[model samples]
Target: MRPLRNIFAAILLLSGAALWATARADDGAGRTPTPHPPRAQGEHCVADTDFMRRNHMKMMMAHRQDVLHEGVRTPQFNISGCVNCHAVKGDDGKPVSFASPQHFCRSCHTYAAVKIDCFECHNSRPETDGKAAATEIDGEDAARLAAFLRETKQ
Candidate 1:
């Protein structure tokens, strides 16, 4: 009986050691690298990479408040600049919209499990020939929207 108990204890210790080694091996073996989203197309960002990563939201919000409430617009901290510079190309060889996960903003936001509402009122894709597509509203769609608004008013 004593010999049997000793053997059982040795087997348990060896199994645990084997399991720990397997886990340690897995920690560095064939692990997928962390996702590194593309950065600005320009030579430099508006701010340093570390600073931008930490405080970009604050900067953009302050800029938004200034632009909307004070009528002050500057190139620094402009959201449009960020969108244009960080635009990622899709399979069609055109810039992807916010709907695509490959879009510059979506890559990090999806990884962080963060919801992005900025694109709700802002264009996710860069303009072509320096013209914005947001300025246009189809006549038929406009009429439908107007009708819907009038019905809801009643």
Candidate 2:
């Protein structure tokens, strides 16, 4: 009976080791995905690539506060400028919306598993008339959107 117990314990130990090795191999098997955002229409970005990569969120949030609270809008660090310059065109030659994986913002945000609400209030595609598009949510829809956002926050 003691020998049988030892054998069962060895089997469990071996099985656990095998499972751990398999899981470790699986975890390291794939190459990490890197984002290759679409090229800008202009020759240069407002800032260099490295700087933008590291600080764009900070700059954009500051810019948003300036625009919304202070009535100050600058061409530099403007999100509309970003959408216009970095617009990724679809097969139809129209700018792709955020729903498309090829959308400029999604290229990085999706790769990072980051959820952005910026597009919920702002247009993902370039503006046709050089004006920010305004989308009005009705009472029921607004409530639903609010609930959805609350759920996603968790």
Candidate 3:
């Protein structure tokens, strides 16, 4: 009975050591890398990466109050601005959007098990894309875009 108990304890310790080693080697170092959004053509963001990671939700809340009560819609700290700039292409080359886990927002959000409701009404991608949206905007089209922003700001 004493021999059997010693063998069981040894096995348990070995198992734990193996598991710890594998966890540490995930990226060949003791530390795991943080998740980063896909690269954008522009090398800048509304804030530095560390600052944004810590304060993004707090910033969004203030942005919400400003947009709703004041109707102030500057580009900074806006969800639309982030989505447009951080948009990552999927395997099909179409933008990976909020609907998919591959989307920039959804990646870390889902990983952290936080549920987000921002995309319930908003389109995941921006209004403009290649050639079509890039082409010269007519007066009517520009007005429509403004109207769309106003309507969605609500």
Q: Compared with the true structure, what per-residue lDDT tens digits does model 2 show for residues 1-154? A: 9999999999999999999989977776545567888789999999999999999999999999999999998989888889989999888787776666677987897677677889777877787786654445456545655654554463
Q: Give the TM-score of candidate 1.
A: 0.68
Clashing residue pairs in candidate 1 are: none
TM-score of candidate 2 against the unseen true structure: 0.66
Off-target runs (Cα >4 Å) in candidate 3 are 1-36, 129-154
Q: Which ranges of candidate 1 are over 4 A from the true structure? A: 1-33, 133-154
Give the per-residue lDDT digits (tens) of candidate 1, residues 5-61: 999999999999999889978786544444578867898999899998888888988
Query: Model 3, range 1-154, lDDT digits (tens) per residue?
Result: 9999999999999999999898878756644345566775457988898898899999998998999999998788877777777788878786655555567876687556566667655556655654212323446445654554444343
Ranking by TM-score: 1, 2, 3
lDDT of 1: 0.75
- For model 2, the local distance difference test gives 0.80
Please tell me which model should have the higher lDDT, number 2 or number 3.
2
Output the lDDT of residue 113, model 3: 54
Pairs that clash in candidate 3? none
Local error of candidate 2 at 134, Å? 8.8
**Candidate 3's error at 76, in angstroms?**
1.1
